[model samples]
Each structure stands twice: as structure tokens, then as C-alpha cells.
Target: MFSLYVFHLTPIQTKNPYPTKELDFYSILWSVLFVKLLIYFLAFITY
Candidate 1:
């Protein structure tokens, strides 16, 4: 399950592939964290 989520995020990470643009990298990191947190929240509720 976690592996699948990481797999899905790999493409988005690869798209940027560099930290030359700080804002873009931070935004992407935030988005990924948000998504992972959301997923965990949903799973916790369901469980």
C-alpha cells in the first residue's frame, strides 16, 4: 500500500528532478506530504 503511493509520487518527483527552483520543490514536497497525510487520515477513519 505504501509502496504504491511512493510509486505514484515518483513520477511527479521525477518531473522536477532538481531543486534548482526552491519554490517549486517546496510546493511539490508540501503537496506530497498533504496527500500522504490525507491518505493516512482516511485510512485511520476507515479503520
Candidate 2:
């Protein structure tokens, strides 16, 4: 999970190649939120 978070934070070359610092940050944020929601869903089900 940590690796996945790091992976999303890493920069990648897009087709347009228009570099932007915010892209990586947003990706990491989305990844974290996704994991958090998944965990919450699982806990809800178990409870």
C-alpha cells in the first residue's frame, strides 16, 4: 500500500509531456483517499 502510494506520487511522462508539479500531488492524494475509503467500507461490512 505504501509502495502504491509512492508509485502514484512519482512523476510520469504523459503523451502531451506537459509537466506540472500538482499532478503528482493530486495522484498521491487520490490514492490515499481511495485506500482510506476502501478500509472504511471493509470495516463497515465486518461490523
Candidate 3:
């Protein structure tokens, strides 16, 4: 799932990279947190 997130962002990150490295780093962090939250939500719903 983590690899999937990285794979999904690669193209968009390459094509329209963030203006600042700090913002880019934050975006990646946020995306990872979001993905983890989403996974937990889905698992909770199903379990």
C-alpha cells in the first residue's frame, strides 16, 4: 500500500513538481498520513 502511494505520485510529482522542497516534503508526509488513515477507516468499516 505504501509502495502504491509512491507509485501513484511519481508521475504527477515529476510533471508538476512542488515549487519548494519543504512543501514537497510536507505534501508527501500528508499523503502518507492520509493513506494510512484511509486504510484504517476501511479496515474498521469491514471488520
Candidate 4:
């Protein structure tokens, strides 16, 4: 299961052939995480 997960994740984490799309996927993933963290921080401050 873990290996399967890593296999699915490898394209985004590594740049072997399809770099552009994978990089875009990574950027979108990071952006979502950043937005979630920002929202959590703001909520904590307000609370």
C-alpha cells in the first residue's frame, strides 16, 4: 500500500520525463497547503 502510494506520487516528486505538468501539480499542491495554513493561522489569532 505504501509503495503503491509512493508510485502514484513519484511523478510529482520527480522530474524524469514530464516535468512541466508534474511541477504544476506540485505547485498547486503547495498552494493548497499554504492556503490551509494561512486560514488556520488567522482562525487561531481570531480565536
Please give the RMSD to the true structure for each candidate, in Å: 4.7, 4.6, 3.9, 6.7
Could you tell me the lDDT of residue 25 within candidate 4? 77
Best by lDDT: 3
lDDT of each: 0.72, 0.65, 0.74, 0.67
Look at candidate 1 and give me any clashing residue pairs: none
Q: lDDT by residue for model 3 over 1-47, one digit each (tens)?
A: 66766786676667665566855776688697877888898999999
**Between prediction 2 and prediction 4, which has the larger lDDT?**
4
Question: Model 3: clashing residue pairs?
Answer: none
Span of ten consecutive residues with least summed lDDT in model 2 = 10-19
> Candidate 1 residues 1-47, lDDT tens each?
55766676666567866565864776577678878888898999999
Model 4 residue runs over 4 Å out of place are 1-18
Candidate 2, 1-47: lDDT as tens digits: 56765564554434324446666666666777878978997899999
Q: Positional deviation of 35 in candidate 2, in angstroms?
A: 0.3
Measured against the true structure, the TM-scores of the candidates, in listed sequence, are: 0.57, 0.58, 0.59, 0.61
Residue-level lDDT of model 4, residues 1-47, one tens digit each, is 33544565576567556567867776677667666877887899999
Q: By TM-score, how accurate is candidate 1? A: 0.57
Ranked by TM-score, the better of candidates 2 and 4 is 4
